[model samples]
Target chain A: MSTTEAGGRIAIEVTVNGTRHRREVEPRLLLVQLLREDLRLTGTHIGCDTTYCGACTVIVDGEPVKSCTMLAVQADGAEILTVEGLARDGELHPLQRAFSENHGLQCGYCTPGMLMSAHALLARNPDPDRKQIRKGIQGNLCRCTGYHNIIAAIDAAAAAMREGK
Target chain B: MYPAPFRYHRAATVEEAIARLVEIGEGARALAGGQTLLVWLKMRFDEPTDLVDIGRLPGLRDIEQEAGRVRIGALATHARIARAPLARQIPIVGDCASGIADNQVRSRGTIGGSLAAGDPSCDWPVLLTTLDAEVHCRGPSGTRTLPADGFVQDLYATRLEHGELVTGVSFALPGKGSAGAYVGFKRCAPAFPTSSVGVQLTLNGDDCTEARIALGSAGLTTIRAKAAEAELRGRTLGAGVIAKAAAAAAAAAEPVADQRGSPAFKRSLIDALVKRGVEVARRRARGETVEVSHEYY
Candidate 1:
């Protein structure tokens, strides 16, 4: 939980998806590294290590944050959700299915971050308009310029989710 | 990108954080949301040996409205502030908070961290200066309050001492007949504004009784356009007078040429932003709902 002092390394516990993990980590470790390397949750891709690109976006304690800019030590005792946690029981989540149907991705480098961002947005506002959807995913940049399809997929997911599909 | 190795100390209280900073000397830095600090660390811009984790400091993330003033705790995230009831009551606060960076960054960036970073391009300093907010800081010695206008001494510098931390910021609520707007021009959601303006006007019918204008990304520090404010005070907010005030604000700015724009280009942006800010503030003062924010092209 809360650490006062621990020399070069510190003990941290975090709940990711539905699993709890405990590890002793160097404070310099980035959260992206924790997810991709330590936990082997490779679904969260790292595009620009800088904060500008939201390729490493994840939901931490209910809000979307850029994992590239967050330290693993900073995420102590928090709940995290990555792209790997989206599907359930071998069934694709509504957003994932919508993305497939709407041709929401091209190179797919930005898919995970876009999915998480759109998921957070839909969680807050189940019926975001086109402009709102655009604002919701503004942090995520797709190099393939597949934003049009991505927005449509988010819209489709919202509608399907609202109808209990 | 891995940050250089640093010892992490989680402070349980404000006094403890200050003590750790004091003990660790200049090599210690206080970490909050880490939206800016971590980026700097990753870039190897500044390598500190110790970090005081103040992210979980109690009673430092509260947003409370008291009597005639609103107080925002240092750890209040931009996302939280953007949706707070206070922001709805004060449109300028919402404009600044909601228009900063993007969703992911806003979800993690704190108002205090933005102010503490002392970046001229940061929106909180400009908006707080327009509201005449006071920064509350606690240090090893004692506590003090500083005006937001002069809090940032220069580029990436602040009045905060080695062992001091900002506890919160408070500003008197704008009285009736007063409203303000924060407007900026940026290339995209994540990019910093090329130039931004914050204008708070107290309008009595058509006559402007008082005006406060602060320019961001137009100088090394947030610049208070006193000459422009002088032009607006006690004058009818006619088109000609507003233009003159905008011109004065453009003249007051000292923007450096960077990838954002040329000096002349930024000056022109400052002029146009001031006018837009004034116009939106005027409309909002008249009880009309005007949605204004950083305009991106």
Candidate 2:
């Protein structure tokens, strides 16, 4: 029997992008599925469902993690950040604007995950150098743009955030 | 892919988690930094009936120094260790933790889980083996300490008993003028290491006072390069000495071929990593702030 039928969906409550949400979710339900399917916040992409690809990256409790690999139940009581929540007052996050201006993306399939990872990176390291930027987003992969633009975008975003832009 | 259907239980304490594991019977696993375990579940490599969520347990994820040794809690993430203050005492911890996988993996993978999972390709077990670290495990029967040297018995196997949880890992703080390095060969940014060498050396004016060499991804379990250690200790470290030690490490390593690399290729990597690890460690012993960023590409 499935866990839901045998017992019931586990009760989990999480604050996502400053919004409190409570739901009954399957213990097996991945966090990526909850965000993309249940919440209809499809910004998080899943290029490779395996641990790699970094296309399903999101921030849980202020740290970026692979949403596809993490179970929904594990996210209980945590604050999650998704690409859908990157903007405030209709203003794009510095990273979002930077990516757009610097051509940090090509196909953009990995944009959301890259943005999330970059957000977390900038949060921890506001003024990371090129080496640190390369290391910061090492988890993320961009099949297009050759990653130079992504690195430049993140670097520019860091500078913008530092100068209060 | 989705994880196979399994019930989840939350525990606030180690004792409670162990009790629940015993009550729930076998096929139950404690969840700590589910970086590897979740992947295993999604791949159907594991089918546990119960998953006791101990990720929120109190005081399990700390990096602290106690009684002349650094005690690392089970839940201490690689990211935490990579940036922890205790890295000053044990640089190898940060050296290895900083390069385990990628940011997401480092943000979630726990030191305890890595050691418990005992994947030969994992970082901590091999590095810990070099530091002579101790794994503190708590179970229903009682608590016991296992040396990292033999904690991993086989591939993906550990000496942990049923219902036992790795509480923390502790190791004696390296003394003054001590430095170490962990060098491993990976195909790219997100692949398991093919072969690695972790070296800890205490030098007294170019004469090696003590040396510990641990090889990873070279065999079923991380192997201690005893002959290599012997070659370094009590000897003046020079090109000749390092060459002999690297040769010893390569001789002791027994690599298996897979997609990561061939046996011959891994053996060559064994020699190269050992040599690089020793050089980096030597520079560190000389009070140079050197970070060995070896790239395969």
Candidate 3:
């Protein structure tokens, strides 16, 4: 039990948004901090930072996980997908477009978390009903919208995703 | 909310993990699923000198059937347990897994961690206690098994010794005509249950042949409502009988006043909750498939 500062820096290789980045980070560095600070992929927000809020939600090994609740070293050699990876070729993803069209966001603090959560839901269940949509994003707390439009956006996105729009 | 400095060691094997834990002694904590441990680290409430990352230890994530038992490896995530065929075969496990926090949390929270964390209000420890499951562990000495009831001693306390790793859990497969239900009341969907009841019983016609009743968020740890179970066993499950059993359970629990509810309120809630749990289990035991999913998970 040496009380030295986080032992020593360790090398880790993580593939984020289809690109691999290798860097040395402190053992205590959280995955969300690594994404936001070292890799500059700040889309993964850290609210509550204790995992009560899903603001730091990201896909690791094809599962949605709160990045704030994971160590950067734990994610070494793992593939991660953050909110920043939602769109491809400069076009907004269907969920992002649906959120905008349906007025799903107001203050936008929780939208990243909502988006990432909904993205994973749609990935697992492409056409979730309203009940399922609510269940899917229930972890992501949106203090602004009252969740009516967020639910509508996810519902609409489910339909569009099913229609291949 | 950044975690304080600590060395991390990813152990590829449980033996190596045990050795590292022994070397690091009390200063070492095993990192599994990183759901609860990471929270402690971020809050700086836990300052372990080293974390043995056992999240990827080989053969620790399988869910399979072994003879008359269903073996769920230590690393099996809640999501995996929820969707596993083994859980569906014993629906109570799936019901419990499906209602733990949310999908994201389920994807990260492991069954072993859930049981090892020993949260008094957590679904797995309480529900597994009712189902009479076993928790397997590996330490410097060797592998061992413990009943779920004794595995969790108190809130945030477990029977796990130093340098010990939970290898997996095995539960006796519920025999035919067996059914179970876990009913919980929460302020919000994602919130931990204020008063929850787990009832597993086997029915012969309308009579309860066997019964195991567990109540959570009602006391220090998940408690067995022995009086309640005794009231139901060998008795014909009528509305009156269920109500009496519910009352017995209410009288058996000792819920403290908390933000969730008042002591009296929780006791009253458990009365109705136990009734609902019994009714659902009765229905399932009668070969009725009742589809239920919580809003949060």
* Worst ten in a row by lDDT for model 3 chain A: A1-10
Tens digit of lDDT per residue, candidate 1, span A44-94? 999989888789999999999999999998898999999999999989999
What order do you get sorting by DockQ, best first?
1, 3, 2
| TM accuracy, model 1 | 0.98
lDDT of 3 by residue, B137-210 (tens): 99999988899876778768899999988888888888987899877777655577887888999998888989
Whole-structure CA lDDT of model 1: 0.93
Q: Which candidate is the best by TM-score?
A: 1
TM of chain B vs. native, candidate 1: 0.99
Q: Please give each candidate's TM-score.
A: 0.98, 0.96, 0.96
lDDT of each: 0.93, 0.87, 0.84
Summarize candidate 1's per-residue lDDT along B38-82 as a digit string, tens digits.
989998999988899999999999999899999999999999999
What is model 3's DockQ versus the real complex?
0.54
- Model 1 chain A is weakest, by summed lDDT over 10 consecutive residues, at A1-10
DockQ of structure 1: 0.64
A1-165 per-residue lDDT for model 3 (tens digits): 212246588888999999999998888888988999988988788787657778888999988888888888889899999888899999999999999999999988888889989998888888788888888887888788999999999999888988998
Clashing pairs in 1: none
For every model in order, the fraction of real contacts preserved is 0.73, 0.56, 0.62
Model 2 gets an lDDT of 0.87
Best by DockQ: 1
Q: Give the range of the ten consecutive residues with the poorest summed lDDT in model 1 chain B.
A: B1-10
